[model samples]
Target: MQNNKSAARQYVCKRRSDKMKITVRVKPNAKKDHIEAEREGEYIAQIKAAPAEGKANNALIKLLAAHFDIARSRIKIISGFSSRNKIIEIIYTRKQ
Candidate 1:
């Protein structure tokens, strides 16, 4: 049992790298906020806020943080800040 736990930790460390990037197509002013995974490293986000004053972008980050089960500070919008298509980078540290 001890060996199995060690192996599982190693497997998780290998699978979850320190950082990853994902592309998202955001639909602002939606009825509700939700995220959909279209494919590997791709997603669709529906936000309840309008695309103004960075409201939609903030909502997207919040939604993604919850979906990925990471802190909001770990997610960054790397590109397409003012457009529907966005590239986000997530950085996280695995707990032992």
Candidate 2:
């Protein structure tokens, strides 16, 4: 069945655990500052900030750093600009 094949593919994908890539949906032109993760979607993050002069991007980095308990340098904007949707790459590094 198609459903079974999809499930099997997903299972195989989950088993191969590697670097994680997260996607976030930013809400620009917000009144206050806040960041919240979506309940249903683990990769989806709701950010409250205006998309102006990379302000939203900066806020996203700071907010994600706090959320993941990682340093700001670990979070990198891999792609997506001039749009509400952004793809962020979280790089993990061992402490020296």
Candidate 3:
């Protein structure tokens, strides 16, 4: 029983690690809000909000969540919180 529990924990950890990381180049204060896939694991986001008081970041998160069809909470800014270029992590579980 102990071994089974340990194996289950390991499996959960491994499953949680099955997430995707992407690089995003954000353009704040654009005319429109949109997201374009530059290549695999890279994106260009044009946001309408200005880069002030985390508004642009929040807008970016909303846009990405809509594009990916996931909750905004599932997306995290792993780096570059104060820059245009940011690294984002998306947590998702594979549907089976």
Candidate 4:
């Protein structure tokens, strides 16, 4: 049989070396706040913040940091700063 597990492991290792991009779809002013991973590299974030004064953005970074178990400083909003659809960057450095 083909060693697919090893190949998959290698793929994950490569991903850790590269900057991971997460495409987020935000719904601000939601009744409740939550984060969902719709699919790989895609997320849906329902924020209670009113999308004002960068509060929503801050919430997003905080949520992502907790989900990825990384520091807030490592996650950045690379684009779509003022839009519902935003691109978030996460730096993953695998501890080998």
**lDDT against the true structure, each candidate:** 0.81, 0.62, 0.81, 0.77
* Superior by TM-score: candidate 2 or candidate 4: 4
Q: How many Å off is the CA of 76 in candidate 2?
A: 0.8
Model 1 ranges off by over 4 Å: 1-16
Higher-TM-score candidate of 1 and 4? 1
Model 4 over residues 8-84: C-alpha lDDT tens digits? 21111114464787778899999877888665566778998889999999988988898889999988898889998
TM accuracy, model 1: 0.82
Candidate 1 residue pairs that clash: none
User: What TM-score fits each model?
Assistant: 0.82, 0.65, 0.80, 0.79
Runs of candidate 3 exceeding 4 Å displacement: 1-17
RMSD to the hidden true structure, all candidates: 10.2, 7.5, 12.7, 8.2
Ranking by lDDT: 3, 1, 4, 2
Worst 10 residues of 1 by lDDT: 1-10
Return the TM-score for candidate 2, rounded to 2 decimals: 0.65
C-alpha lDDT of candidate 3 relative to the true structure: 0.81
Q: What is the lDDT of residue 57 in candidate 4?
A: 95
